[model samples]
Target: MQQHLLRSTEENLTLKTLCRKFSNGALIIHENPVRQVGGKKNAPHLKTTAYHFDVLDVDWINTESSFEADFVLVTTLNPSVSAIYHQRATLTLSNGSTYTPDFLVIKNGRPTIVEVKPHKFTVKEPWSKLFEEALSICETVNVRFEVQTELQFRVGNLHKRAEYIAFCARLEFTSEDILLAIEEVSKYTDGMTFDFFMRITGLPKILILKLVASRHLYLNDALEYEDCSMIYSSPAY
Candidate 1:
């Protein structure tokens, strides 16, 4: 039998966080849980929010998952945990290695492949299959995935918006239903975009994809290479 023990207080949660842009244009702070996790190390900046989520254990987002608050602490990190990420390591893959995606996200009715990498080796690919999968998006748009920092993933707002929109539409909403959505979404349009949209919107993957595929909304240029990008349609001129 395997026994799980709590870490000692003196262990000191040390980690190196890297912020990378996702295919959806959201910045994510990434670190392996095996190496370290987020916590309080010292005094945090007045602007920092509390950290709530850990990497590695999260599942590949599926049909019933939420886009809201997947992670917490939008503004800043707790001081004590801030320096835990000081130890940085480079990723190395021998030739003929297999590349497995870290986490696959289904956004806007498609799969957005997300691969978390540290700051320095953000471009390193250990799996051979990844090279082709990463390159596969070169000609597509519906796919969204990339290396990112743990901090970026914490914002939780970018995916929120898209999720909200998707949720509203998934109800098979009519024009009348859109009115209710307007009331809800109107309160937070400051940082509205594809990434935030998916986060805050609380919508289903299919609805979000429909809106983008139809070009009713626009996404950041960074999303062009995402495999999920193909889900969006050409906008009506």
Candidate 2:
């Protein structure tokens, strides 16, 4: 989020608020985070994840649009065209390759072509819609785009992103909801490495890990490690 006007007061947000704030070009980030936010499959572990996810949302929903364009969309899909797109993946356009948009927003007005780009310089552009639409009034065509960071877009809405991730991780899980989300996310993902968890799990990983550490692993005197290198470090060889 940027240093701009304030709209939120003391009220908690609803789903519609989430939809509105994160609608098209909003950027969300997980403030302080950990690798296990999205992984680990214990009952106590998930509450931790949920908490952090909420924190990210607390930060995210407060994001502001940039004064200058960081990511630009020069669309020629025809203003007469109206459509909604369902997305499934984040993208980073390879050099000279075309950029794929993640989702489309059709409101009988000008288009935003919904995409979720990184708040950092990790990519040149966002990816395309993951699924196909059966609606005849719509067309799903990929396009090329460019990104030039005009300002540092805050990952404030990330807390909301975390919540959404945790929820999606557990849909149809049919168990202790939190743990189920954990189990689903952990096992469903293969070659589960810590760095991979960092990117995929996002913020809930921090919240989830904290819950696990304090409740299950840490509990008493705040079990602390100086660095993540300690995780795989052996006892002085």
Candidate 3:
């Protein structure tokens, strides 16, 4: 009986390993972008801006518009967002029109196709119809579809803060600096103001912004960065 049980356990382990491999393969396949973003030389009409995201495997991701750029920045700061891709998928509508989404975001381990459009344009003709078709396609595939506007991305100077943080995050900083900042902030149970934290750490303002951008520290409810802004330690620590 003991010998039989050991053989069964070995077979189960092999099966589990194969299942894990299969799941990983499926995830990779799903994450692959259906269309590639073109550069200025290839597509003169489209304005491309390269954005950096540490969470994404690629060195840089390109955004076509300011709205898209803001979206990328804010999404990068979100702890729940694990991965992001630009122009990730192209879906065919029932009327034979193809629609390419602005972003493919992996948030909380689920895939969501997001379209960023101006508020005025969302209510207009062809765009409205196109969005409807895109929603249908996403629903069929069991993927989430969302339409984001400036209201969502530019909330109370959040985009401005995100952009500033992104720029500052590029500056040189060491792991020791980050650890020290976190340690100082963790000492305050209720958190502390940005100015107070800065005073205690003696780290440069840029490095503090870098910590916020990297999500090692968080901002106030509005996500604005200022002297009096409330700074909180990351719960992960």
**What clash count goes with each model?**
69, 19, 0
| RMSD in order of candidates | 16.5, 20.5, 10.2
lDDT of the candidates, in the order given? 0.32, 0.28, 0.70
lDDT of 1: 0.32
Q: Can you tell me which runs of candidate 2 are displaced by over 4 Å?
A: 1-84, 87-97, 122-154, 157-237
Predict model 3's lDDT versus the native: 0.70
Candidate 1 displacement at residue 194 in angstroms: 17
- Candidate number of the best lDDT: 3
Q: Assess every candidate by TM-score.
A: 0.26, 0.19, 0.77
* Regions more than 4 Å wrong, model 1: 1-92, 95-97, 103-113, 117-145, 175-214, 218-234
lDDT (tens digit, per residue) of candidate 3 on 4-38: 11123332343233234324311112233444455
Candidates ranked, most accurate by lDDT first: 3, 1, 2
User: Alpha-carbon error at 184 in model 3, in Å?
Assistant: 1.4
Top-TM-score structure, candidate number? 3
